[model samples]
Target: MIKTFKSSLFLCAMSALFLCSACHKEQSPIPEVLGEYLKYHAEKGKTADGYDAYFDLSDGMLAAYSNDTTKAEIKSIINKITGNKNCRNIYSLKEGTVSKLDKSQTELYNYILNPSSYATVAPIEETLKRITSQGTSAFLVTDFEEYSNGVIQQQNYAKAYFVDWLKKGGDITFFITNYLENGKQKHLYFTVFDMGEHSLLKDIENALEGSKSKYTRFNLTANVVDIEYGYSGTKGGCYHDESGEDIVSVTNESGEGDCFTLYKDYHAEYYPFNETWANIVKNAKDLSEEGNTPKFMHLITGPKVNLTSLSGYNVKELDLKVTNIQDDFIRFAGYYEYTKDKTINVDENGKLLDEYNYPNKNNATNMPEIEDMLKYAGCVQDGVATLNVDFDKDFNGTSSKVKPLDLLRVDIVIDECEPKYDLITKLFSWEGNNSLEQAVRNTLQEVNPEGQVIYTFFMRDGGE
Candidate 1:
């Protein structure tokens, strides 16, 4: 998730390969080995995007050919990207030891592992060619809050699995989220890092952890689409009572009363709805379809941060002992009131407008653009977006009823970062000039005292 790529691959290579290689036949100059690598990958034709093929000559010597005199100054930088405290883990893989690597991985690993023996070995250029050409990606969904002080540093497959993916020209994108059920914070993390770059983050692993939180509706009722009408369902006319008595169901010409008045001249068949209800639905659907830009009443109580644009509710007071069944998800029974008012039109229906703008489906919108909202919360990666907004709406005969827990579940879709090609494997077996190689290493470390400097060797095959 960090923006700046760290050059820690050599460190991992040293640990995994120092003993296995003809690499340790004697002390090879740091610059020579590395410079040779850049030249070699270029000769074989590889791309490096904007990332130039270079090495921190000093860092390589300290880690691979010398002692550990420096530490990576990147803890604070890592936290900036991951939203976690310390840099949890930066997993890498080395030659001959990548787990579950396919045939292509095996060939590439072998070639890099024994450069001395590579003359007899055929090139795995086709595998690398296919990978870089087609391109691949990863979607790493994480619940970073679950980490203790934001640390997930026990580097195993859980952390390092993406390395092989990157090697195969797959880029990675991370989606970090905190889990919640029944409005209670789970204080847990459920993540899935897909090399195949699947959008869904595997499963929502349920576990009993710290404390639980439930969504409490503070009687915050929204008047979603208020409609003033004469009479909708069964506009009364002449009707017989259960006792076989003739009865009339209104006192005035307007369809407004429920009392049975004396019946003399009443003759109108029952109709179920009025123009008011039809117009209300039509207006609501239109409002939502055209990008819910208008404000509506949104009622929420307490210390939860809504990382979405569907905010700004008309605050109200309420008290209701809601669904008490213990569960790990927020239950919804969408049913908001449609109060009959003295006036008969869809005018300034305030807070109710707000709720329906984001939650109402089966009307104007079937999906909510929550990904746009996620950019503020750091679910940021260009081209990477989320899909499938899971929400439910209640309706009574074409009239939508908004209720508790009308929410858009937090999930993301990321277009994976394409792996950058590097021309590091172009190094071919050539008799080394010992004095020249030694002079290169001495100059490599002697450049600048402040830190290791990048000593780029112009790739032999014009790789970049």
Candidate 2:
């Protein structure tokens, strides 16, 4: 009877050990993934099949370009356009009509110089609509001075269309030339619309090198900024992975491998290592004639910590607070919860599934709202912005310590960047302006209210 009881006890112990091993296999730790959707790749410029050139035959435009030098500049622009190894079309733009003209330079010049022969005024909005409808890149030469029934143009009718074009990811390059029209200095604009990845604008820019013209180019392309971990080699006991530009592994000097420990008293500050402030100053100086400093606003969102691995630790809630050391920079923080029902789907190799990708959650609904936690004044000095992240914030007034072996997959995004350059103000004249100023201002304000994401960073925190 005693021998039988001993064998039964040993079998029971073996069964318990097997069950424990199976549970451990099922609860594998989550892997750290960063920068899944932060980088922006710009479409490369290519040569188009053909291009269109439109000349406004209005009296103002004809008179502005009638000078020998200005006329030569116009012909130079046309020659550059036709110089390409593709068919080019020239058209006379007037009063909601685009009539094809002879490709001959003499005929084109004759048609452009004789304003009285074609005395109809072209509606700017109609011309823009025509260009947009064609869905092809084109050049528009005009004085941009509008007349309605021989009255001064009052309202900006083309503002809405320009805004629409900009919002649709189109780019515009304005080549402004100054000339004396009727003994007064006037401006003639050569506007190029780039609807796709075409090298037309660059070609024109190259062709007009050393020419007396000022140009301004604007596009809806994403502006990405570089970021680094820590300030002045002070990583606060953390190390950055050289393979990833945005990855930060939180480990001490003695720690080895991917995971490391963060004690309760862990604290650190990171600075934007790039020449952001210097560039701001340079951009303002280069673009501004009035020496006015440009203004930029930053919108910080989401350091979404994937707390899937912390489930075994009973981590009901975790609070990660980011404080801005400067008042000029916005102050915001986030609180995260470990949802037991939410299981991240991963493949056999531990890579996240397509639906569960990181840094791609750009939808505002998926982002956590900013709650009142802590505020620290950040500072900008020596052309660098310093920001601090405190991990020791108390949770539920009970625990302020991050549990050992806990893994935090932190993903932070920076978006809605507004870098208002003074060049915009210098682009158009407001005094007795012929709707250009109003149109430009309205379009800029409407289309770019909240700029796109400029940077996204990923960080991981683990306990020993």
Candidate 3:
């Protein structure tokens, strides 16, 4: 999730030792380019949701802030602290690795500081090479801009390179330092911070060991925090134009709401709840314009059984571990389209009371788990590009014959609403004996009278 906010980034002076040296006449006069670097993130990490801001660099790009005077002051401080006399453009490092770089290190930087290239691609040659051989640590990677002949282009490989880098040997929390790359970017030095951890595999293990319930539904929910999406990271954001994939687009360019939508299934008519923690949803997955059709929305490794209402019924959290099965993976995806008239709010998990007093997620907020009810409908691509989970631990279903079913909940916390979406739950009462399609039509009239958004789930391939 790459953010592009406009404000001065407050620099808290830190005491980290950087390896800098004096430059010769051939080197660019710029003392040192200060900026943040992104580390390799794997798809097989732990899984947990709730506002977990990568306080560690906010990890993804967000916000649009810029302050030159303040930034200059920070750079001055860095020069005094590090005593680094050499300054060079980000491209200089690409000429070749600095002699002082540690073994297997690739000195790269990104145009992350660039608002225009924020959504576009970037160069990763030097960095990608490192991952292929002995592991490498990059100073900068996806933030550079390249112009060929008269065309403006970016080399989009940081993500793939990072995945490969993690496999070889990567550190979630590593070291970084920024420099005065140019007039636009000031001295942005790197400091260490916490990169929240998640182990989807571990979550599953714990769930299975806890308890069991005959009510076989895996009620899952993705509390979306923030939406920093778009292929255009220029001054004003733009749409994604690059092509080469499989996600089929439903609508072309509409006026206000989502101009494009890719539904996961005819069932889950709803969404892409990327990643979380800070109540902020930052996507770390690779997003392409082509992969639009929802073909992979199943929690393949989950229990096998019949399910009841997700939030309507009482059940154990452990049953929702659709993520526990080895080789199989869990994916939470959906489409969403927000227009000026149709507004929605994503409320996080809070504390509340059920029929009986207890600490339940429902207690925290009104967002209920989607169970045997209407699925979903939205407009947009799937969630983030890099969320993947594969469990290797050994475990048998709660019962050899009776497999538990997994059903996730996606709470749509609607705030100050438009007339049509008033008191959405009213539709839940209309689930009469009519076919789901008919029920949906009537429900849509009550909730989304104008068809703002809908909810449906994607059944995993061959999944009952």
> What are the lDDT figures for the candidates, one per model?
0.21, 0.43, 0.22
- Model 3, which residues run further than 4 Å from truth? 1-95, 101-124, 131-138, 141-374, 377-464
lDDT of 2 at 260: 28
How do these models rank on lDDT, best leading? 2, 3, 1
Q: In model 1, which regions exceed 4 Å deviation?
A: 1-284, 288-327, 330-410, 415-418, 421-464
Best by lDDT: 2
| Model 1 global lDDT (CA atoms, 0 to 1) | 0.21
Is 2 or 3 the stronger prediction by TM-score? 2
Off by over 4 Å in 2: 1-51, 83-88, 105-118, 214-426, 430-432, 455-464
Top candidate when judged by TM-score against the true structure: 2
Query: Order the candidates by TM-score, highest first — what do you get?
Result: 2, 3, 1
Residue 392's lDDT within candidate 3 is 16
Q: What's the C-alpha lDDT at position 53 in model 2?
A: 80
lDDT of 1 at 245: 24
Q: RMSD, each candidate, Å?
A: 31.8, 16.6, 29.4
Model 1 over residues 179-298: C-alpha lDDT tens digits?
Answer: 333443321111222223122212111111111322111100111111122222322222223432222211122333312211111110111111232233343344445444441111
Which tens-of-lDDT digit does each residue in 343-369 have in candidate 2? 223345544433333223441222232
